[model samples]
Target chain A: MDCISARSKNIKGKGQSKLKRRESLAGLLFVSPTIIYFIVFFLLPLAVCIYASFTNWNILSPNRVFVGTLNYERLFVDPKFWKALKNTLFMLIPIPIYITFALLFAYACHKNILGQKVFRAIYYLPYISSIVALTLIWMWLFNSKYGLVNNFLSLFVDNPPSWLSDPFWTKWMIVIMISWKLIGFTSIYYIAALKSIPKSYYEAAQIDGAGPRQQFFKITLPLLTPTTFYLLVIGMIGSLQTFVEVQMFAPDGGRGYGVGTIVFYIWQKAFSSSQMGYACAIATVFGLFILVITVIQFTLSRKWVFEGN
Target chain B: MKRKISPVRIIVFIILLIGAVTMIVPFAWMLSTSLKEANLVYTIPPQWIPKPVDWKNYIEIWTASNLLTGIKNSCIISVSVLVFCTFTSSMAAFAFSKLSFPFKNAIFVMLLTTIMVPLVVLLVPLFVIYTKIGWIDTLLPMIVPASMCNINIIFFLRQYMTGLPKELLDAAKIDGCGYFSAYWRIYLPLCKPAIVANVIMLFMITWNDYFGPLVFTHSESKQNIQVAIAMLNSHYIQQTDIPLMMTASLIAILPVLILFIICQKYFTESFAMTGIKG
Candidate 1:
């Protein structure tokens, strides 16, 4: 009886192992496509980009000759690179402004006011619409002479700034356009965050004689830090990569003026001038810069972001 | 007793009203301009409503630009990529969530890292690779890479699948169902809500993509809607044909606007999910 029981147990063990092996095989088969795709498209391209950045791999040239760090060395001193970086940083000015508006709008809507749904949808409209279409509409709206914006400004001032042509006003136009596009979408996120905060906290604050402003600063603001940090990180990354609007607004890479973002400059160099190697160098540095900034944001967020359930 | 209206509430209402108007004026202007004759576009008061509402610009856009072909190309790219990507991502999600595999965590982590790497970094290398393969002007460059897998969809689906009851799939296996059949017959049906939310998000991103289509395709025949709109803008700006440009912009925005209105719930819900969970 004991021998028979041992043999049965041994057979059961073998059968279970076979089933596990079959499951493993199926799992590997399922993920094979994704693995192959990453290997070919993502990993391979990344390796090639890093390698080519160190060499002179011009698209028009017959051969790519190795020139160690020459591209990187030139990129460090390139005035165009610095100007593009500056413009990209300048684009970040709207992040705080839009986030503030988003928070306010979100707070107002959270009060369950009438027409809340309509307001939410209307705000998110610019975000969903095609950037090209919106940029064109903005260009028309900011038309120096006949634009509705300038026409309105002329009601108060002797002369409105040439929003599209004048370098200074052009920057403000881009900022305004960006803020308008982002505010609604950012508000959606804020609304979600606001919804997640417990009403008990506010009720507690009210019992403690906290005014609306005190309740907001004491309870609401602290709870919303996580959402704010998330938006800030995302907004920073997006600002650093601003391209389409810059390209659409100033097709010449904002040549004499300083309106070109980093991605715009990279696109111009890589595609337009065929400076593939140098563009790769700029791109590599930019990517690393983003990675570093993101890491720093995450680290700094620990100090302020609320981690409560 | 009737509740009294607070001064603060009234102030908030007025502020929201102003904000809503600011958000909508551009779109209202776009529609107004599209209905205006070319000469009336630059009128001094910037006609909020055209003197005589002309629909000629709307009719002229089809023949004057590559709008038709752009729509066709965009549809093809968006549809093909979404269909293939949805299938592969779900399958991968199923495996990651339910099945046991070797080095699965390592592979997933590697895939997640790709999300952090910006597309601009890959531009030079990808452009080079496409040029070498004579795919610079082809839709294949835009379609193929994206169709392989969407990491975001896979990640979202995996999180969703993990929340589903394990006994559901185990019961299917006991009934002699293969792993693929369990995924298809059981998990896929159960995962519909999550999949729909992801599909809507993917559709929006793929449809609204400007940079990918812009960089990959050069020819007028091959251009997508966004690029086509851009081309029309640059081409007509020299002639200052603002009305025609407005008409084209309206046409380009209409499909997305319609989709957003129809799938409004899924759109906001998916965004909220990503924001909070991410």
Candidate 2:
């Protein structure tokens, strides 16, 4: 009887291992396509980019000479690169202000204000629209001569700044356009975050004689930190990569280097100038900047981003 | 309990109203300008409403530019990409969530890290590779790479699938269903909401993608609506026909606007889900 029990237990263990093996095979089979794709597109391209950053290879050239540290050194000294970096950083100014308004707008929508649904949908319209079309429309609106904005501004100011043409106002124009497009989309996220907050917390605050303002600061604000943190990171990364508006509005670096973003500068170097090596080097550095910033954001998020109880 | 019409609510309403107007004015201006003649566009007061609307600009622009062909190409490319990306991402998500595999965590982490590698970094090498493979001037470069996988979609679906019951797959397996069938019949059916959400999101990404088409396709006929519209400014830079540009912009945005309105619930809800889950 002891031998029989031991033999059955051994057979059961063998069957379980076989099942595990089959499951592993099945898993590999399921993920094979994605794995193949990642290898060909993601990994290979990344490998090529890293390699190309160290070489002087134009796209048309057959030979790529190894030039270690040369491209990186050039990037450090290049005034255009610095200007582009500054321009990219300049766009970060609106993010906090944008978040504040998005939060406030979301709060109002959460309270079920009149036409809340309609307003939310309307706000998301620009997000859905093509960036090219949106930029062109904005171009028309920012026209120095016949623009609706300037036309409106002429009613008070003697000289309205040329939004698209003027170097100083070019970054501001892009900022305004970016803000307009993102406000609706970001606010919707905040609205969802606000709604997810348990009503019981607000009720508890009220029971403790907390006013609406007190409830907001003490309860709602704390709860919304995770969402805010998410937006802040996303917003910063996105602003750093601002391209279409700046590219379309200020095609030639916006009348004396007002709106040349890092990506746009990279595109100009690689595509227009055919300086593929320099572009790759710039791209590598820009990517590292984004990575560093993102890592810092993640590290900082631990302090303020509320982990739900 | 009856809620009072508080002054705070009134203030909120006014603020939101102002925002709504700001949002709507661009489209309104586009429409207004598209109807006005070239000379009438630069009026002092700015014609909020055109005296004599010129619908000819739309007709003329549509006939002259690659607008119609662009629309057709954009629809085909975006739809194909949408379907392919959704399928591949979902399948991968299923494996990650349900199946027991060796080195699964390591593989997923590797894939996630690739998201940090921005598209701009890949631009030069991809351009060189595409040129080598003779994919430049073709839609294949744009469609094929984008279709293969999207990290965000996989992450989203994986997060969703993790919340699902393990017993469902177990029950299916107990009923003599194979792993593929479990995925196809059980998991796929259960994943409709997620799939719809992914579809809408992918549609927006593919449709709004200007940079890809612009870089890849050089031919006039192969260009998407965005490229076509952008070409309008370049080709007619000296002319500066604002009305024609506005008309083209209107046409370009119409499909997305209609789709957004129709899928309003899914569009908003999907974005909302991403924010919370992400």
Q: Clashing pairs in model 1?
A: none
CA lDDT of every candidate: 0.88, 0.86
lDDT string for model 2 (A65-182, tens) is 9999899999999988899899999999889877888889898888778878898888898888999998888888888887889888989999999887776797888888888888
Per-residue alpha-carbon lDDT of candidate 2 for residues B1-278, written as tens digits (9 for 90 to 100) = 33459887887888889989999999999999999888998788887899897888978997877898898889889988998888888888999999999989988988978777788888778888888899999889878977888888888888889889989989988899988889889887788998897798898888788998988889887998898898777423677888989899999888778878888888888898889875
Question: CA shift at B150, candidate 2, in angstroms?
Answer: 1.7
DockQ of each: 0.76, 0.75
Off by over 4 Å in 1: B1-4, B235-237
Residue A297 of model 2 has an lDDT of: 95
User: B21-82, model 1: which lDDT tens digit per residue?
Assistant: 99899889989999998888767877787889998998899998899999999999999988
- Residue A94 CA displacement from its true place in model 2, Å: 2.4
Against the true structure, whose lDDT is highest? 1
